[model samples]
Target: MDQMFQIGDSILTVSLPVELDHPNSQAISQQIDEILQEQYIRGIVFDFGNTTFMDSSGIGMIMGRYKALGMRQDSIRAIRVNRRIYKILNLSGIYKVMKICRQVEE
Candidate 1:
């Protein structure tokens, strides 16, 4: 699965692929970091509409980004997560740490 990222004026949206496993972790992390460094980012939004699988590494990826944004009083959000993924987020306590929305509005 290919990971794609898009940056808007107020947010960075990472369009994660079908599986967010180890193989794509480094690439996603590096791309996110680069985007963060290259922009005066206000927030990050993870679009999970197409994601079919995510393991603990995926949890770590989101947590890492959450911690990064916390330092600057910013935040990261997750959107369009299906029931299975929502359970993962809930079980990992990520739903408490980040906002999960039904959609992204401009």
Candidate 2:
């Protein structure tokens, strides 16, 4: 569970873990929800560079944050999504809600 947050401007860039499954997914959602509450976050950028696998819980987590952010629809994004995970997001219609970038963070 390697996660790090890089705050940029009003974007809360989050580096996700390799396996974003249950338990941790719920924890991550809770943590992000907490931040959105006490802070003035305007957007979120999820970095999926290291993520290899994920379950439906990942989508739930993202959706939870999107709703919690008051539907700041255009501010949510996902970065460095590999083919496998990209398929997951694509099939889940996540791209319609957030931007997908193949660029990895160096």
Query: Best candidate, lDDT-wise?
Result: 2
**What pairs collide in candidate 2?**
none
How displaced is residue 65 in candidate 1, in Å? 0.9
Q: Which regions of candidate 1 are displaced past 4 Å? A: 1-3, 71-74, 103-106
Screening candidate 1 with a backbone cut-off below 3 angstroms (N, C-alpha, C), the clashing residue pairs are none
Q: TM-score for all predictions?
A: 0.87, 0.90
Tens-place lDDT digits, model 2, residues 1-106: 1347766687798889989999879988878877777778899999898999999999989988888888766878898889999899999998888888888542
lDDT, candidate 2, at 58: 96
Predicted structure with the largest TM-score when compared to the true one: 2
Q: Candidate 1 lDDT, tens digit per residue, 13-103? A: 8998899997776678878887777777778889999999999999998888877676444388898888888899889998777887766
- What TM-score would you give candidate 2 relative to the actual structure? 0.90
Deviation (Å) of 76 in candidate 2 = 0.5
